[model samples]
Target: MASINVDFSVGQGAISSRLYGAGLEHVGASVYGGFWTGPARPGDESRSAPPVHIGWREDVLTLARALRPGILRWPGGPFSQSYRWRDGVGPRGDRPLRFDHYWAKPEPNHVGTDEFLDLCRWIDAEPAITVNTRSARPEEAAAWVEYCNGSMLTSAGALRLANGQPNPWNARLWSVGSNNWDMGAPEAARRHNLFARAMRGVDPGIELTAIGGNPSNQSEWDKVVIGQTAEQFRHLGVWAFDGVASVEGDNPEDLFHAHVASAERILWTISNAAYRLDEMMLNGGAYVGVDGWGIWKQSRQGLQHDYDMSDALIAATVLHGLHRLAPRVGYAAWGNLVNALGLIQATERACWATPVYHIMKMFRDLHGTEATRCTVAGPAVAAPGGNSPVRSSRPPYKGMALIDASASRDVARGRYTLSVVNRSFSDRHDVEIDVKGLPTGIGATSHLLRAESPFAANSAKEPRAIEPFVFPIGQIPREYPFPAHSVTVLIWEETPGLT
Candidate 1:
């Protein structure tokens, strides 16, 4: 049996909602068949088409709106490194169809800066754009900031007005390129700092993010970047992913715990970086961005993943871990939004949410403002290694409990939410959540996400194959039985103490 102790009085900083962010890139069908429709044919030069008039799917937009993503990272993964922003802007008819060198696909260039910012407005999500510092010049990056957030009197702002938008989009977060190594040549950290300075000269209010290594692996690089260029940026980017494939004949349950350990390593890295930044006395508080993260064991030409029950459990645990590490992490985008390693799968006629999508929505909507400290006390299990996509840098194997849990508190709203991830394959653990230093709750609701088999996944025909089910539970019992390989979120009303 596993027991969770949640002490509301013992908490870290406020959990940032932006940690539950999503990203969009010009990869595979993510842009072509995922967001747009009505054919990729050349448009009539006479018609002067803006993206709003272009075939953006209402059904997909409806699904995107449901997640209520806090922020949307635009125009890349690798695409940002070579993305030519000027080519994608202005008249849609004049925009050229260029070859995306990164993904080796023909980019239609229909969705540009304005279209992406417009989509953000429609969904009410903050725009987090990554500037090109590899193929493009620093001037181009500055011009992009001006076009998005500059005043109407400026030259780029006039072009934006001429293009159609009268007001500035006012995007806040600007990522100054990604990891780039020139085949054993010079790295791009210094170039990244130069671009950051130029972009800031354009809009001093925008938050700049610099590309760096994961918290644990890059000791020297982290020290140099934070010590040298820490004044130029406010956040550092960290990318992480895992595969559920069997390693040394390990089972799916072992893979699930390994993912948890990997996420914990990411948190540790972020905390270490934050401490380093503080010691240097940087101009601003530097946080971390887990910008690219996912669990993909399967891939196709477009990197499609049929997320299974085990993936859903991993997603829940990862989000739970992020909530606990709120003091150092301010943003996270779930690698992608559609087509390639996405939460929702798209086709010509229909779009459906995956098991990962349901779990993401559950945590995003149910999470609160503050993280409540939780400790899991139970018999430990040895977690196997080799879950990460990168070799030779797998998370260290440690004794982990079968139950992993995190809790959040909304003091203003008088609500507390607790999420538990059960990684055991066979044994059912009786989880007793002891609430201390808090008033008793009057009502409670428990939502459970589980599948008959760990490998069960959802298809278009069976979209709800692995979805969450809600049930009203009895009085906060001494202990509750949590089945093997399941995730449960319990929401209850707490009586607020007198101020």
Candidate 2:
């Protein structure tokens, strides 16, 4: 019998502000065809009609609000550096036509700055714009910020007014580039650096994020870029940092593990430089390969490969990493909101939330206001490469029990929630939580999400593949079999006298 003990007395710290927000870049149909089609005409109900009203989708807005996302990235990943603000502004008819370097599609400029701002308003999310840095100039970057955030009295402000948005937008969160290091082309870093300098001159208060290298060379890039850029902005007295991480994988399990390891590596790199983790975005969660255009596919084969039984476990791993390293990590965002690795998938006719979405919602709803310290003491599960210890260890946890736990306390409510993910595929582990020293009592409500098959998913036709169940904790007794491939959220409330 494999058993584990958890002590909730040792508290970690407060939850990170970054945990509150997510990102939606201009990739796939995420922005254009995905979320931003205008509302249908008075009588037309066609699926092709714009799914989002005023270039925003209601389903996407609803999901974003549920997460209480603090900030949303806009306009581009690689596309941002090549994007021209003028093309995305002004009347849609008059807006210039351009090519989206990333998705290989004609840039319609339909969801311009004003429209994005409107979408943000609808969802109640803060707008974080990424300016064109590769081929753009400092003056261009500064002027764009002025156009959006500056007062109406300025020239750029006048241009914004002429474009039908009377007042300056007052956008605060901004970035210089996206993966400027990976294009492997000439003048990439130089263009990004120039944009950074000019953006500071526009509005000193705006938060600026500089692009770092790829995940493979993250540490090396951090050492070089942060070392140099820190000096450039030292005189201007602005906040400067790097943007790292990308979304690509087959299933939630593998993707989740990669995200956990990547985050740790990036955090370590940024910490060594004493630089702030300003705008670190996680990999894509919604994208599936369609005609080999994106990393994942839309077929069941692709879905099973990328998002099956591993998704819930992966999500647990991510939450645990963020909670444990709350002090260093800030501003973590998922790839998109609607389609292409998003939480919600919407067609003009209908909408549905993914299993990952439910997991995220559960985390948002139950995880308390602050992180608490908790550790697992149980039989060691062997690593895949055998129990023999070797130099340069990479695996964070050893063994097969696959136990991950996060504890949080709500000071005002006098409640604590423990979220645990058991990764064992065949055997069930018996968990014993030692709550003797906890300030609160032991009664708890447990919510479990599990499936018989690892490759299960919720489709438009069949929408109930994955769901949660709630039951009294004590009813199950000491030997609770946490079914194979499952996520469990245990809510413990205090008994008035026991405390």
Candidate 3:
């Protein structure tokens, strides 16, 4: 049995709702079959006439809308470094299908800048465009900003007007370049500064995010980039997709324990990096933006993996950790929104939300903006050695709690929400919670995400196999049973009067 104390009077920080954002890359079906699957070309007269061409499938769009994605990054993930924006815009018949050197596939360029923006508009999502700096010059990247956001007086803007878009896309978020360690040139930092200046010159209102450093080691790279581009960028970009897998004849629970601890360590590193920024004395308060996240499973052609319930639980833990980190983490986008390690799997005819999708939706729809401080006193579990999910210089910390939790209070709705993840493999712990500075008699609603087994998953055939089950409690209980390897969210209306 575990007794947890949650103090609503103590506020950790404000949770950034955009932290739950997801990304879309131009690789694999993520674009073609995933987003742009119209019967006719985008600019064709048939697209506007009867039997109009819907670029994105209706069912898929409807499911995505439910997730309420705050921001969507476009046409990237190593593809953007070499991508030529000019090739994707204009009449579909005139646009060229170019060979993608990175993915070694033919890119039809049918869903170009205009198409991407149109999709964003349809979904009501903020556009986070990554500019090509590895293969394109600063002026080329600057032209992209102008085309999307500049007035018709500008050259690229004039082209946009000629192409039929009367108004600017007015995109605010931009990533300077791809990962500098892999594809970036030695002078890429300087080039990023040049790109930032040129793009911002076109529209100073836009927010620029530059590569801070490799996620593995960010100190040196952070210092280098901050020295070069002091105040040009608003956020320093970082990527994380840590996952656990069972080895030969090993227990699966071992992997889940290791994965949760590994995820926490990575978050701590991000927080440390933000603290170090104070010593660098940068101009604006720049936060870490984990724009690329999700397991990078080894594959031949595409990055798609059948995410199990354990994977979904790990993702829930990650989301909880991000929300707990609060104002330090400005935004986080799950890798590939549609097919490449996507939350929702989509075929031409149908789309199915994965277990991870349900978890994300639950957190996004339920969690509030203000993070509250919480404490847990329970029998702690230790992650076994040599079972570390990722290579780390240090071992897992001693006395890591078996139960991980985060809480928030929504002021406008007069509600409070608590997200808790039980990391135990086989042991079901009794959880007793006390909310300081609060009265009783509050009605509570609980949403539980669990399955018969951690390895359980949902496929296209069984989309709701591991969905959430909601129950209403007459009052907030003094104690509850938290099952092993599960994610639970408790929400209640905020009591106005004091006890």
Candidate 4:
């Protein structure tokens, strides 16, 4: 057992709202059945019974709102290149039907561009549209942006107005490619440049995210995309870099650890640059229906790996890396939001948030945009060194702690929140905090998200497995027992008078 001390103070710098740019993609029922299917829609009468009213959409919106998400990436991963905005926009009867490549299902195009924009509006989230970089031309990409953000005078803008949305949909975020590797390198590079140039040419006001390679190949892809785009699109207000998720290994834990390590590497590379790049979109976690590799796995158990505790821990660790390096890593979008490989699973009858969802929600709810310094003098958790049941093949960090902790101070509210997670399987240790440096006269509250049963989880049937509980801390305690396998968030508020 060891003790940790954290010092926090009000600062003038504000945490980037982009830290909250967590997004999801719809491949399976994630969009249509999960978020858009109406009660009146022809389907299983039981599942479709609830009309597709604002209420149903509001449920997912509520979740996104609670997370204070800054942006919602839509429509595709690999599927984006084939997605046509026109097909998904107007009335359902007029929309053309298409086959979904990723999910091998029929895409009715019911949840089109308009619906997605409307969804973003309802949740007050910025829409991050993924254009067809692999298959569509630069003009096509430009048209999508023009339809969304251009004034009603232009051709695409006029089409948008004719579709019933009179006002131009001023969405600021756009992704040039989804999974560029699906296409070869030469073609991918050409497509990436084309979309980048087109997007900039169409709407100089929009922030563009040009696709790089998988995180593993970031150095190579960054050299190409960033280097090439820097010359032409840099002046067009295009900003941000995008990477796909690729963790090498079959074991779930190993895959998780690999992704974490890769995420750390992405942060390091992007942060060390002298000139500030707009943002780096680090895509991590299991892709829907995919196994350890980015391709779909057949085993049902393999498909549900994201629901496991080991995956949850890995997700948390990935988030830890993101939060720890927030200065450099500007944006993070979970590969897919609703279907196939997603945080939320939707059946015709119901939908439930998975373990990854809970973990991300926890991070979103408790952690702030800015990273604070935390020092711990405690026993280190032995790195299983890729042997742990979770199969993380990445080399271990030296002297990693059984207790992982990070802190942030919110200057506006004059408050500090410290998040601590004990990853130990057996050791239950008492913890202490030294917040003497924070501005004084502040009240404090602590919230713990833990379960009496280490294996307890939130399921579709029982969704309350690991929820949050708050405790008041009038005085800083010298010690508090931290149960193994738990995450604790301690909040300190500035009270205004006493030191």
Candidate 1 residue spans exceeding 4 A from truth: 38-54, 181-187, 214-217, 250-272, 275-284, 302-304, 386-396, 494-499
The TM-score values for the models, in the order shown, are 0.90, 0.77, 0.90, 0.80
- Where model 4 places Cα greater than 4 Å from the true spot, the runs are 10-14, 39-48, 54-61, 182-187, 232-310, 385-399, 453-455, 495-499
Q: What residue runs in model 2 are displaced by over 4 Å at the alpha carbon?
A: 1-10, 46-52, 164-168, 182-193, 231-306, 379-401, 413-415, 436-438, 471-481, 493-499
Which residue runs does candidate 3 get wrong by more than 4 Å?
40-53, 183-186, 282-284, 298-302, 385-399, 437-441, 494-499
lDDT, residue 320, model 3: 76
lDDT of 3 by residue, 1-499 (tens): 7777877667888887677778888787887776667655556444442222356666677778788777888877688888999998898889898888888889888888998888787766778999988888989999999999988888999999999997999998999997656643337678888999999888899888878665565777778777777678888787765554433347566655655565565566567667666677545477777778766533526475567777776777788778776767788888877877888887655578888888888888888788888777777767643232343333545666888788887767777888888878777878998877443567778899988887788877887888899888757668888888788998887653211
CA error at residue 104 for candidate 4, angstroms? 1.4
The C-alpha RMSD in Å for every predicted model, in order, reads 4.4, 7.9, 4.2, 6.4
Taking all chains together, the TM-score of candidate 3 against the true structure is: 0.90
Model 2, span 367-419: residue lDDT tens: 77778767765554433211111112234333343677778877666667788
lDDT string, candidate 1, 296-315, tens digits: 55457746478777777777
Query: Which is the winner by TM-score between candidate 1 and candidate 2?
Result: 1
Native-to-model Cα distance after best TM-score fit, residue 56 in candidate 1, in Å: 2.2
- lDDT tens string, model 4, 182-297? 45555666766777777888878766665555435545555555555554332111112211133335543334333333333333434433122443222221001100111122
Q: How many residue pairs of model 2 clash at the backbone?
A: 22
Cα-based lDDT at residue 273, candidate 3:
60
